[model samples]
Target: MNAKTPDTPIVIIGAGPAGMAAALALHTVGHTPILLERYREARPAGNILNLWPPPIKALQEMGVDTDDLGAPCHTTFRGVKGNIRADVQIPDDVVKAYGGGFIGLLRPELYRRMLAAMPEGVLRPDVEVTAIEDLGPTVRVSLRDGSSIDAAAVVGADGIDSMVRRLLWGPSERREHKLHIIGGYTFADVPGVERNEVVLRHDRTVQGTYSSIRDNGRDGIQWWVLEAWNPKAEPPADLKSHALSLARRFPGPLAALVDSTDQKHFQRWPIRDRKPLKRWSKGRITLAGDAAHATSPYAAYGAGMSIGDGYTLAQELTGVDLTDAAAVVAALGRYDDRRIAHTTAQVQQAYVLGKVFHHAPAPLRPVRDFILDKTPMLQKQVGEKSPAEIVAQLDEMGAGLVRA
Candidate 1:
């Protein structure tokens, strides 16, 4: 077992939404934390966005201002086929009821806001962590720089390829991982689109959608995302060629939008998912965010879950007796248990949604429309009800989450 030269009380690996959020939570509880990251700075490739009701309220309490980079979008549009459907008129109060307002922001802008909230010396970037050794009560992390800082606990908030999770789980866990080099460039003055709304255009062989970013006071910038699922193959080498082909799938003014897009300005990312790890806590170390559980974008819960992980983990950690290692581990167990149920439901539902709603089926379109028409609450239930409630609803309806 590797041991550490005792350092900070807590050290979070990866300084993205989850890591930063964890630091913020620690600060609120009056605990100073140390954060480390391999990237030079926070990566804001995706249009930063969060839709959950709970965390928005927490952010308000934290007093972190994001008005310069974020906006409350009251209207949302979602549906399928060559049709317009499901226009949701969510009022500000209604949005707040969920937890916080339905807010959107640029990723860089949000990163800036999070940085301002933390104390100096807490955030460390551009340092790559190579390994984590579970040394009984605490974990000893070895960094590429050849120096290490030990902590009472280690957080695996690093994105999909988390180093902490790799060591703790070993290299053999069958958590299916895949990479997708998808890109999105910010564009101003996109025509025929409403702000604060996401518009999806379905092509039988492909799918296209544009979601609005928070108001930057200029013309709003929208992200056009393309997703293709292929498990065994590697991402294409020629990004522009593949991007152009992906762009061609969308007709109407979108072709022009894609043409106007700077493929070079686009953000590409690999995709990975864990089959709900057996446990998130091993003694004093625990997993948070993607390291603990990564969901497919089909659920759009990555950011939400990251924030939730930070929120709940903080709540549990602050309440637990930190002096007692067993007590600390138990508190983390609660964090893991809570996150697993919440995230697992999302992963399963997202896989089902990708097939049912995303796929353009001429035969099933009418039936889907009819089902949606009959029970708009099926979608409603998923959002308004708890995860346990969602499972119960599925049982009551004699329905089950679809498999990939």
Candidate 2:
């Protein structure tokens, strides 16, 4: 926690939710800020999203409530083998107990909200940042139009392909080479597709889930998918055709969701993740959001993590004078130390969950589910898990992450 100091204009790169959230948090702590975006009119692919519990808590602390944004999220269906008709509601009351409840939103709507909350000059849409130079005490952010400004600190919320991370941390070692993700916002709405349920395909080999957003008359519905694949074989550019191809492989209505798509709507990416860095900052230049930690889309925590980072960074920079060189660098180093472990653990946990869910054969799947289905106590005794109070008992000590 930083003590409140004179306002410093922190430069935030990228206008995605992570960058926007960071900008907002910095503003909350009394800082002048500037946010840059590469696209003048960047619109999300209209992907629907359900905020999980931990992030729900994070957002509540940040001041954007899910209940205020849109509809409540309830689990209509989710499971590896069979569609368990469980009331997996992170129930409104349960969510409220934890300080926040879930709310669904269209990407554009969410984008609009974060932008609207900014204090006028903070967000500069259409301004693309081309280069960033670390000047020890100050970082210079150069935009595409050949303009530059010196700032006390610069944040790279530019995403996994973060230019800042590349310049500073270098490309992290590739954690996995081949991950198949078939995603698209679609128009054809399927019957009984609950607006909140995270629908999982029982054809476990083809792991997929769709969060239901309200149907617009044009694009009736939307959903996305992630599965194991060979990157050298099938990359994401061919996402549409490949998704349609994968659609033909499934037996249930899940395939119908895919059949409704044209190539334009199909989006595919060979999901790649970089191993986490021990340091997320270098002097005055700091990486936040996806720049620091990039997780596969399977977890849907990427945006939320950025929000957390933005808030944490704002908290760290509260008292430092931007003009001071040593303070800026030291603050950044401390920021990295605090965040690297937390974010890396999140990324690694997603990987382990991916392995446990996709690769586990049927027999093991039952035993895995049985333990989970029984009670949280059984789960904790067996492993150090924390999905629910009862679920916390699933995993053993240090089972989720590597902490330095």
Candidate 3:
């Protein structure tokens, strides 16, 4: 890729949750990893993230105090035409058993917190990785500034449109699901909105919700609108107008919130997920987070999975000789084996749930609502995980990783 370089055993691309977690993981194992990001600074405009317990626990182990950023929330689902469908409350006992609670925090705050947790100078912002070469014995990562670094291994933690993933698994191999989503956040004095509750309204192609949440000790609201539409159809230029148009069909308070939200805070983008790849590693190169398993937010597990990947990867590489190419390959193989199942299940579920949330054809709407309303168990199974099962899994994941 470039002239011979000093051995930087691991080079992590991207500074999002996955990359940051991987850096911390490697550091915990006594490896000083070089983390690179394309942006000049952190872009934390993804609105609020609903991080689950498993990943929250992992972040706590890495020294992040999520409790301050978020509080536990009970989720509700509304059917077509703003009708209540089902509600899923995370029981206190389950929260106590898992030792972590489901939380919502502004994505920007989480991003800043993660960067702050890293050692100074470990994160190289504004440095873009132009290319990567997985040499038989080493990985050469090229940067936009005509510089390169050789590492025993390279991590493709770069987001969905990951350059490292493209380098390893050609562009044609990448895939995206057919879903469109546009939404944003704003500070509002929503009188009736409960601070500890988030709601989702599934109304045909227009499916979304707005919730009151605590951010930096201030009250704020976050909202989103998702729809199953033509992938190639152009998105509306004015997201605020689009959200407002959809809001016309929403309940009074929900519509008012959308109408009152500032146009500057409205963000719009298509929801895309990568098709499950048969493999996530080649030679000394491996992928993590969105680069490995980009999923639709409908499942709300993608971020958690990314953080877990980094933690589990660190666990896998704990005592392995980084210079040993065979060991690196074997460790990555195991990482893929461990992660593929969980992420794949989430991807499939997100796709299925996206369909369920959107219009279920004219004749199926009533049936869909009936089942959703009658089946508390179904909602429970979808959103609630057994605390005992979660704790046991966490114990398994924490077993091999080096402690902080």
Best by lDDT: 3
Q: Give me the displacement of residue 309 in model 2, in angstroms.
A: 1.0
Model 2, residue 334: distance off in Å is: 4.0
RMSD of 3: 2.9
Runs in model 3 lying further than 4 Å from the true structure: 1-7, 80-84, 89-100, 173-176, 375-377, 384-393, 399-401
Candidate number achieving the greatest TM-score relative to the actual structure: 3
In model 1, pairs of residues that clash are 53-98, 53-99, 53-100, 54-99, 184-267
TM-score of each model, in listed order: 0.79, 0.76, 0.89
Ranking by lDDT: 3, 2, 1
lDDT of candidate model 1 versus the reference: 0.62
TM-score of candidate 3 relative to the true fold: 0.89
**Candidate 2 regions with alpha-carbon error over 4 angstroms:** 1-8, 53-70, 75-94, 97-102, 186-189, 202-204, 214-221, 234-252, 260-265, 356-404
Give the per-residue Cα lDDT of candidate 1 at 251.
53
Which scores better on lDDT, 2 or 3? Answer: 3
Per-residue lDDT of model 2, residues 282-387, tens digit only: 7788888777887766555666667767766766776667788887777777767666776777687677666765667777877766644555632342123323
Error of 2 at 317 (Å): 1.7
In model 1, which runs have C-alpha deviations exceeding 4 angstroms?
1-8, 45-50, 74-92, 96-100, 172-187, 225-252, 357-404
After TM-score superposition, the amount by which residue 221's alpha carbon in candidate 2 deviates from its true location, in angstroms, is 5.3
lDDT values of the candidates?
A: 0.62, 0.62, 0.75
